[model samples]
Target: MANPIKIIGASLSQNVRKPLAVAHHLGLDVESVMAAPGDDTIKAANPSGRIPAMDDNGFHLSESVAIMIYLAGKAGNALYPEDVQTRALVNQWLFWDVAHWTPAYQPIQFERAIKPMLDMGDPDETVVAAALAKFEREATLLNAALDGKDWLGGGEPTLADFAAGAGLTYAAPMELPLDDYPNIKAWNGRVMGLEGFKKTAQGQ
Candidate 1:
């Protein structure tokens, strides 16, 4: 196994869950060093002071997807896959998660769930409404893509699934409109059912 690595992030964070879930999927049982948002320690790990940075002994890696890819590679699993074409497709979805999918849900999560918990403020109805509209569009595309497939982009679950599906962690709390996207709803259940996902979901 690779030298025991330490994940720095809260358990509830969607990005933080990726490496933990990947470790669990690979049977690594890795430990994490909890660092919540706005923690100064996060700056040393990620210049942006983001959660989900990783320390592999002395080696450091920021970005959840990058850490996930490294963990998957270490595990010798095909979660990211090897075929050039397949890999490209997997990467495409990963990019989409970070760019399109994540952004769409972020406002909702912050405005609806997180803000209130942190005593930030009430959710902005205008933001929620706009996000909901955008979410519906993306969710529809994702739903159609997932049709008749057990996982995203076909075959077994990949980083794309984790990257995108993690947002659903806040789906209910943020009141994300999933009613119109049955395929996405069902796929999310399958992703959540994985033993690795279950084992690594709660942060210490």
Candidate 2:
């Protein structure tokens, strides 16, 4: 018997959800470890002090984005496409979220929402507002890309949607209106309605 790919992370974290969702889409059997705050297990596995570290057949890997791409390539077509251009498009959005959206928006969302809940003081209003403003701008760019299409790269939901949606889930509590971006709204709804999406969202 092989050591199943062990996904260690807090289920509620968006970064962790990316690979988990991909696993569900690919129907792969994986062992999930719900690493919690103050838990030393994850810190030991990932020196960066992050969740979403994995042990794939003894090959230790960290970082959510890297895990996703590795799993997709291993799972093949279910999540990763064979077409070079399509694969490039998926990678493009995945990179965009990491380099642009996640870096810009997640800190504000965490500080504003999660921190206060954990008894941490409220985040600076100006900073949150500025981040949200920037988020809205990039969201508008996404809306434009979604114009008349069902998904980011076209009809079928690709890894791009998963990557982007995982990052965007931070907005779930904000209840922002999708009316301004009908296509995006539809896409989000579609992604969220997947088999394990609700389960994953609920920290399954």
RMSD of each: 1.8, 2.1
Provide the lowest-lDDT 10-residue window in model 2.
170-179
Candidate-wise lDDT, in order: 0.84, 0.76
In model 1, residue pairs whose N, Cα or C atoms come closer than 3 Å (at least 3 residues apart or on different chains), thus clashing, are none
- Model 2 residue 74 CA deviation (Å) reads 2.2
Badly placed stretches (over 4 Å) of model 2 are 36-39, 175-177
Please give the clash total of every predicted structure, in order.
0, 0
Q: Alpha carbon lDDT of residue 126, candidate 2?
A: 76
Poorly placed runs, candidate 1 (over 4 Å): 1-3
Candidate 1 overall lDDT versus native: 0.84
lDDT of 2 by residue, 1-204 (tens): 887788888876888888888877777778888897446777767767687988777788888888888888784464667788887887888888888878667867687657766778867777777777777788888888888877776668777888888765756555355677677787888888776466687735
